[model samples]
Each structure stands twice: as structure tokens, then as C-alpha cells.
Target: MDDGDVLTSAGVAAGLDLALHVIRRDHGSEVANAAARRCVMPPWREGGQAQYIDRPLPDEAGGGTAATREYMLANLDAPLDLAALAEHAKMSIRTFTRRFREETGQSPAKWLTGQRVRHARHLLETTDLGVEEVARRAGFGTAVSLRQRLHAAVGVAPLAYRRTFRAADHVRAAAAEEKA
Candidate 1:
């Protein structure tokens, strides 16, 4: 292969495999593994989206609590509760709960927790913050809470997660510096 070479595969499955192979070679297995785990994707699918597969399409219908959801995302560090969310949405508690479930397929608390975990994961992968700092930034209130939540969500400790992603980053940075 040459510099700036382009290789195209015939099918989606082959393309996925080629993409993963490139990532693995460039970033190492730990980074590729971390990407696969965090994306909940296998890196390559055997038969890409076959007719018998059950893949739900995106929801084109918009309205109902989307604004509130955006607000929640913005104020992740705030001590938000069901009552706060309901008030923001101008919905009664019961009505908000029902609508939230219908829209997200999860309870408000569950969804919020998942989002917090995702934030924590991003911090772990991208930042050099300590666990306690990451917890505070991720809105987990405390390191213990962050650890418990992370364990429950992704079955890995914060340090381990950071190691997998950040170590790969450090390696890439060093390689770039060396080339420079």
C-alpha cells in the first residue's frame, strides 16, 4: 500500500472488517476493544442487516419532552429529580413519567443514570481527571457512587476504563511526537 491509499470493500460486512482492521493496526487492540465495547458494536457484522434482523429505524416524530431532555443534558451536574423534570416539561408527575417511558423506553431515573454513566465514560476516556473529580463532573456526587454506577453500567472500574482508552491515546500522541 502507498501513502493516502484508498481501499474499498464490496459489501458492508467486508467494509466493517477492513475498517476495524485499520483501527486495530493503527491504535492497537486495547483501543479497538474499548471502541467496540463502548459502541456496543462487534466491530464487524457477519451478515449486515439481513431481512430477518430486527433493527428499529430512527424516530422521525419529534415533540414531547425533547426540550426537557436537552435541558437535562445541559444541566447534568444539577441535582435533578423527577419533580424538577416534570416541572420543566410543564407536566404533572404521573403524566411526565408515562410520557418519559413512552418516549425513551425507560424510567426517568434509569435514563438519567445511563446518561450520567455515559458522561463519566467520556471523561474517563478523554480526560486525565481523578476518579473523584470525574465523579463530580459526571454528576455522580461521589467517587463511590461513580464506581458503583460504572460497575453496574459497564462492568468495569473507572481506572481500568481510563487505562484502556487513554493509554491508547498516549501511545498515539508519542508516535506523532516522534514522527514530528
Candidate 2:
């Protein structure tokens, strides 16, 4: 293949995997991993929507909160504490605490919970991984924890969320196929 030329699989999903592979090659694994993680995409795509998924934005806007927001989003699968986040933002725990609430209109803990829930939602939609794995990846740490958080966020269990979204996807796919 020439420099400008590329090869891809037959399905649109395969094309996305090829694009992600190129991204991983060009930008290094960390960037590619973050991109994939934010979209709740698996490292390998086999008829999946990783390539076509829209990336979600973090809550914080520009200014001092930008760096902290990036740090939070990048580290969602890890334990996050207010002190650590404040330190990352290079502000005192007190000031950072206040600013975080002012900027995002949610406490750091609440924000983190929301982020995790969002991640969980994505995982439910796209991946076939079990709820435990989804919980871990979403930073919930355990299925029980994920259940509580997801319930709080959306008033439904993770499995139910998966079933709902998956069914929805299937219906959409059938409709599209019929049209085609």
C-alpha cells in the first residue's frame, strides 16, 4: 500500500477499527487508549461501533478547571479524591473545592459519580463484557457499587440498561437493513 492508501474490512465497523489502529500507531497507545476508553470501546473491534461513536466532553470549561477536568476524565478508572484533584489543578484543596463546584455546578464526588455512570452507560451500549468488568472499567470497582450508582443516576440496573440499549440498537439495525 502507498502512504495515502489504506485497507479496511468489508463492514463499516471494520473501517472504524482500522482508523483506531492507525490512531494508536500515530499518536501512541495512551492517546488511543484514552480515546477508546472514553467511548467505552474495546481495544479490538469485531463488528462494533467504536469508530462511529461520538466522544463525550468532560464537564469543566476553560481556565483553571481545564487541566483538572482532563485529569479526571483520563483517570476515571482510578480512585479519585478531592485532595488529589485539587493538587492536580495546582490550587489549595479549599479553593479548588469551591472552584470545582462553581465551574461544574456539582461537587467533585458527584461529578466523578456522574462520569462513571456515563462510562457505564457507554459500556452497556457497545460491549459484550459482563457487568463486573463494565463496573471496573467505569471506576465503580464492583458490581454492587455500579448498581447503586447506576440506580442513582438512571434508576435502573446495569444489566437492564444494557438490555434496553441493545434492544434499541437491534431495532434500529433491522429498520436500517429493511430500508437498504
Candidate 3:
């Protein structure tokens, strides 16, 4: 509904989204995400997205996945599999799988792919690396795989994503280098 210059939300959850929108709009996404992290909330969720999901949130009850999560992040490029992750967590496959889903609200593979994509997005935004190089760095193996995953996730090709998210400071640095 429209109210003259006024904003409203459907509920308390929606209010969080609205507040995040205001913060992101004014202070930028990095700041907003940092604030969200401090509160132990997930990163930016758009207003139009589902307000609730069935999976248990990290703030809810769960355990034994934290150390494994850190290890996976530090080795995103590694060829990780269920057995390997389970071994790292010192649990059997069945137990690790259950605990992972409970803690992260997604399967280990899904979470790993998302993390890889996030890292790919970061590399694309921050560096001038070719798509193939970014793919290798981000563990996609080949440019075709990178293209498919990046497109499916963000609806953009790698180069286009680079252009979209290129940091302003990087542009200035490039310009300065060109002058020198």
C-alpha cells in the first residue's frame, strides 16, 4: 500500500528487512552486512524474499559443525566431499549430514557451492583476472562451469558481474596507474 512518503511493513520480520534496507541505502552493503553479522543475523535478505524458512537457524540449537565450517571456508578450492567433511568433523556421514543441515539450513555441498560463488564474486569484483583464472581460484575448475554457476546464482556473466561490482577504489587506483 501507498502512504504519502511513509513506509510500512507487514510484521516484525519485515521491519528488520526495512531497517536493513535503510541501513544499506545510507551506509552501503558492507556496513549493513557487518551490522547484521554483529547481531548474528544472516547477510542482506531482500524485502520480497520469503520471510521464513523451515530449516533451523544458527542461533537455534545445533552443534559440532562450527569447526568444520571454518575448515571448509579456508579450503574452498579443495575437492571436498561428504566423506572428507565428515572425517574432518570426526562424525560418520549420516551424523555429519544431519548436523550440517541443522546448523546451516542447507546441505554441506550447497553451502560449499554458495561459499565458492561468494568467493568468485569477490575475486571478480576486486581483481582484473580473466574468467578462467577466477574460476580456478574459486574452485569452479573451468570457465564454462563458472559461467553456468555464476549465471544461475546472479543472472549475470562473470565479466558483467565484475563490471557491476567493481570497487570504486580499484577504479581510482587503475586511473592513477594509467597516469603514472
Candidate 4:
């Protein structure tokens, strides 16, 4: 589950993801990617969102909203409505929405918002960016929106979340130094 120092998972796939998350936490993404390749697993599956998905990640080459999702992820700050997403996917709005829900088990808006929240959390953990900037980048438009969404997702505001991550990082660093 990854509540700070304690990490647990519900299944074998989740266990693999937990292990990969620990590798990424300690050794970084490249190391985690290499380890995933050695094990014949997808290089990365976001730990937070995967847990709630009813199905597996879509096969991008086999056709689905995968390309559109990639586009959405890259342009989180852009105004991405159903029209934009449908256009990107080369499908009608109804088809795109249906396919997106089928693939991801959530509506396009919900999935996008979740991705933005996840991005904001990552930024909070890894950067010193101000909340407003993080909000803008995460497509929340304002600090208040970021605060609301982050609170809804993680039950904490942005600054508090950052502080928690920072404190954890400090603890990890201290333990590493002690070991050395």
C-alpha cells in the first residue's frame, strides 16, 4: 500500500509494482526500467492509479485510447476537453469516451483529473515549485483548485503533502548515512 515506510500489495502484479516502486524510490527510474526489462514487465505502471483500475493497461499498438492518453499526459496544462481528446484519438466523441471507459474503467475527465493529481503529487515530492505553479502545470488552473483536488485525493493539502514527503526523504537520507 506504500504508507511511508510500510509497503504492501494485494496481488502478484501489485507485488511487482510495489517492488518496482521501491526500486524507483531508492535507485531512480532508469534502474527500475532496467529491472522491469529483466523481468519482462511493463517499464512502469503508476502505483496509485493501477490499484483502482478494473482492467489492465491498454495495448497501445493494438488500438485504443492509449495514444490519446499519452497526448493528454503530455499536455496536462492544455485545455483538453472531450472534443480535443476525440480528435487526437481519431474517433467520434461518443466512441472515444466509450473506449476510454472500457480501457481505463473511468471516464476521460476522471482519468485526466487523476493523472493531474498524480503529477501534482510527484511535483510536490520532487520539486520546490510553488503551489500555484504546480497547480498550473497540473492543469488545475489555480492553487485553490489544486488544494481541493489534492485534499480530495490524498486527504491532505499540497504543502502538507510536500512536508510529509520531505520528512520521509530526510528520514531515508539519515538512515542511509547511518548505514554508511
Check candidate 1 and list the clashing pairs: none
Q: What is the lDDT of residue 179 in candidate 4?
A: 100
**Per-residue lDDT for 1-180 in model 3, tens only?**
226467677877667766776778789999889877887777666444422222322542347988888888888777889999999999999999999998888899998888788889889877889999999988899999999988877777898788766767778889999999
On lDDT, the stronger of 1 and 4 is 4
| Local distance difference test values of all predictions, in order | 0.78, 0.79, 0.80, 0.87
lDDT of 3 at 12: 73
Rank the models by lDDT, top first: 4, 3, 2, 1
Ranking of all candidate structures by their TM-score, best first: 1, 4, 2, 3
TM-score for each candidate, following the candidate numbering: 0.66, 0.63, 0.62, 0.64
lDDT of 1 by residue, 1-180 (tens): 213577666565566666776788799988877777776678645643322122232242674877787788788778999998999999999999998888888888888887788888888888888999999988899999999998887667889778866887899899999999
lDDT (0-100) at residue 79 of candidate 4? 86
Cα lDDT of model 2 by residue, 1-180, tens digit: 115566556565565666677888889888878877886777664442222234355444565777888788788899999888998988999999888888777788887888888888898899999999999999999999999988876767888878877998889999999999
Candidates 3 and 4, the one with greater TM-score: 4
List model 4 lDDT by residue over 91-144, tens digit each: 999999999998888999999998899889889989999999999999999999
- RMSD in Å for model 3: 11.0
Cα deviation of 119, candidate 1, in Å:
0.7
- In candidate 2, what residue range of length 10 has the lowest lDDT sum? 46-55
**Structure candidate 3, residue pairs in collision:** none
Model 1 alpha-carbon drift over 4 Å, by segment:
1-61
